[model samples]
Target chain A: MSASIYLDHAATAPLAPGVAEVMHDVLVGAPGNPLSQHAEGRAACAHIDAAAEKVAGLIGAEPREIVWTSGATESSNLALRGVAEFIGAGARIVSVVTEHPATRDTLSALAKQGVTVDWLEVDAHGAIDHDALAAAVAQGPDLVSIMQVNNETGVIHDVPAIAEQCAAAGVALHVDAAQSLGRLPIDVSATPIALMSLSAHKIGGPKGIGALYVRRRAPKIGVAAQIIGGGQQRGLRAGTLPTHQIAGFGAAAAQAARHGIASQPEWARLRERLWQGMAPLGGLLRNGRPETAAAPFLSVSVTGVHGAALITGLNEGEPALAVSTGAACSAAKGESSHVVRAMGRSPREAAATIRFSLGPGVDEVAIDAAAQRFRDEVRRLRTLAEAA
Target chain B: MNRGAADDAIRARFLRPTYAVDADAVDAWPASGAADTPGEDARCRVFLAVGNDGRLKAAFAAFGPPVVIACADWICERVTAQTVEITHTVTLADVEKALALTPTQRYAGLLAIDALSNAVINLGQ
Candidate 1:
């Protein structure tokens, strides 16, 4: 058997070059609490500050706006739950039905706590209807929370347009940019986005480290800290920050700034090549609007094959294909993708969906091999189904 | 479902189901019976041919998780050279034990038994 090919970068990307070295240096060399008054503490604080600058630079934000958190999940929790708490009960938040569970579940919890949530629906292509969004904004909700990119289908939401509507309505817009932070060019200064959740692991940084960008400019945003003990991070997120993880995140962000922007077209081309290779199978359906999808993502749902059987065959085949049936977080639930189901596909079709997300090292050769393995698995499963 | 959670027996059988009938040869079988669990999409079909000495030859085709496929293949391998009456006597426990199926995978065993029972009935008619 040949080596396995990894296409599940959406789940977690491998650490990029320079990220591990910085992390190692910080782990071995920097050994003081960032908030302590000692010299070592001051040195640690400087590292954290530099990392924040790099993270801020990637998204065109001031370093002061970045509030470090555990990861995107925590950042989202801080963004949504904190915003809801700040606005108090009876606050209204408008968000899409297909936001990541971090946002969706947080909103659900808030709804139970007396906040009214209006979940905007998406069309079959996983694209939100602008009119529906406009209507939601017209209601003057306190906040409009949406994701910049769909984790399951790679669908890119027009966050700028959404932000425009929210800004005009005098509403705060919180974007879960876990999937978009480095993969896409984001200028928070150019857009009126009030709050954004970001994760480092998704962009080849260390896991368990992320940031929530709280606008410090006009329409300043504030979130009541969910994790509070120490009065660190200006009391917004209170914890002794992980110095090495933060340093690694900054290095990853720097690398993304240096390479991620220029690599978009190449990634998009590879994605297209992958799709074209698998398109000949006839019953395969692309889950999102290709023109609007992120460059690294390609999600397809196959017909005429049992979803479970297909996944098994691909995983067990020689040179196993490392892909996901949906979001890795939800795959273990053994249920169809809610994101795909929300887009109007039946449960079975949603179950059959495969999300192939590319990363930095993936090339055309890997894409072709993955496509061939995908086709072979689908054909094999279809043949078995026909025999039955 | 957690594919790695499957036992080695199930993994081996699922990866290379030796008793699975080829799609082209499915039409040439003397008698075949298929059963599917409606909402779960767990399905199994058993194909049988009576040998010259009144014994049975069996092959299976399945559409479901690896457990279901492995269960169906196990059932076929168990009943291949047995008499039709013996095939009818194959129980759910028999299939479950052979595959080391868990409680969650009990449906695979049931589906296999149902398919084989139907095949036995069809062979009689």
Candidate 2:
């Protein structure tokens, strides 16, 4: 990492070391269509298959279960739309208000088309009410969609327990695991989840590749294909696969598998150190419960400070602390966070909230510096507010 | 079109806020007006203590994005020492041009106009 602190890993991580090398190799060495019958085409197909297996291994899934798409957005779109199309309209889907835009908006669109979308309410700490979810599932919805980890607050959802509920209710569970895939371990075989969405860029891979895991075993999910050009990936998604992107994603996933889980303790310590450094700023309120939130994340909202100014201050100062006001997409739109608002925060508190997501190479020194920068900026803005 | 501290003028004004309302001194202002622009989640309140000669001494308080606060600060600088009539003529376009605000930041300009217009109206009362 450079001297500037990059604490927005959930938005996107810097590419892992070997990722560039692998992508370059694929781009230069084997530039052939994977669908062709030639030797070069066979080699390209092997490259894609290897990438599929690596991604599958990361989630403890079968290689055949993975369907490649552009990114998490596409994966989520396919997972939600495909199921809705297959089950037909009038089928009910249960979800939460805190889902990423890809899932939330897709669910909304489905709702517009006569699919009943039951939005589950979250508590003040951003946790979904499990009893509510179970009750929704008991109503025999066709699918239950929720994220494995919240992108804004880093609140980790209890997906395994929810998956068990869905299984008992005979309802399909679709998890958007874009934020949790590499940072946390997910064993598909262990959990009774029916589908999942995974992203490459969020885990240090290339931006354009992602996967949707469709369970092919005993309760086979017969999803209709959203894209229909060339019948690639068993007619689920159709297009010429980009070998370079897939190879980069595979390289990133392999490295994350090696280090992501193992580095959690260090990340947790850094997160705590960051809180300690900023705790003296008396108005700081941690957004999520530390016990339940992911270790790489430290989300807080400062009272008596404008959120936009705080973000701008951090982003513009010396050694700019690259954090987020919320998800990158929502921030770009200049809209308040739906996730924060859903958790019952006032618009001001939601606007003032900052999400700091840590990753590899963000050490103790960086954490301390970032925390101090946050403290100084909040104090400066508070002074400005008071003076105003 | 939010200008950060990288813009030296915005940085200086935002950090110094030379004409910001000191909370303790707010009660002493003879006339005050406030406007809330709900669309942008911005609020701007302008307090004035007019001189005996009718020259205005303007102070402002605002809450919202940095751009809004910076715009309020810039407005305070521009409107101070001017006649009440001139303060009313401080258009939204003028604030936009003076601050180099972007298309998305036009709301801040509107907010500045509302607060200054309200303050000028209060001077009559």
RMSD of each: 2.4, 3.6
Instruction: Kindly report which residue stretches of model 1 are placed more than 4 angstroms away from their true locations once superposed.
Output: A1-3, A327-334, B1-6
Clashing pairs in 1: none
Q: What DockQ values do the models have?
A: 0.54, 0.34
Q: Candidate 1 chain A, which ten residues in sequence have the lowest lDDT sum? A: A326-335
Once model 1 is optimally superposed onto the true structure by TM-score, how far is the C-alpha of residue A9 displaced, in angstroms? Answer: 1.0
Q: Encode model 1's per-residue lDDT on A1-388: one tens digit a residue.
A: 1338888889899999989999999988889998999999999999999999999999999999999999999998998889888878678999998988899889899898899999999999899999999998898888899999999998999999888888887888999999998888899999999999999999999999999999998765668889889889989999889999999999999999999878888889999999999999999888998899999999998888777777777777776998888742212343788899888877777788889989888998888999999888888777767778
The global C-alpha lDDT for each of the candidates, from Candidate 1 onward, is 0.87, 0.85
Task: Give me the displacement of residue A74 in model 1, in angstroms.
Answer: 0.7
Interface RMSD of 2: 3.8
lDDT of 1 at A122: 94
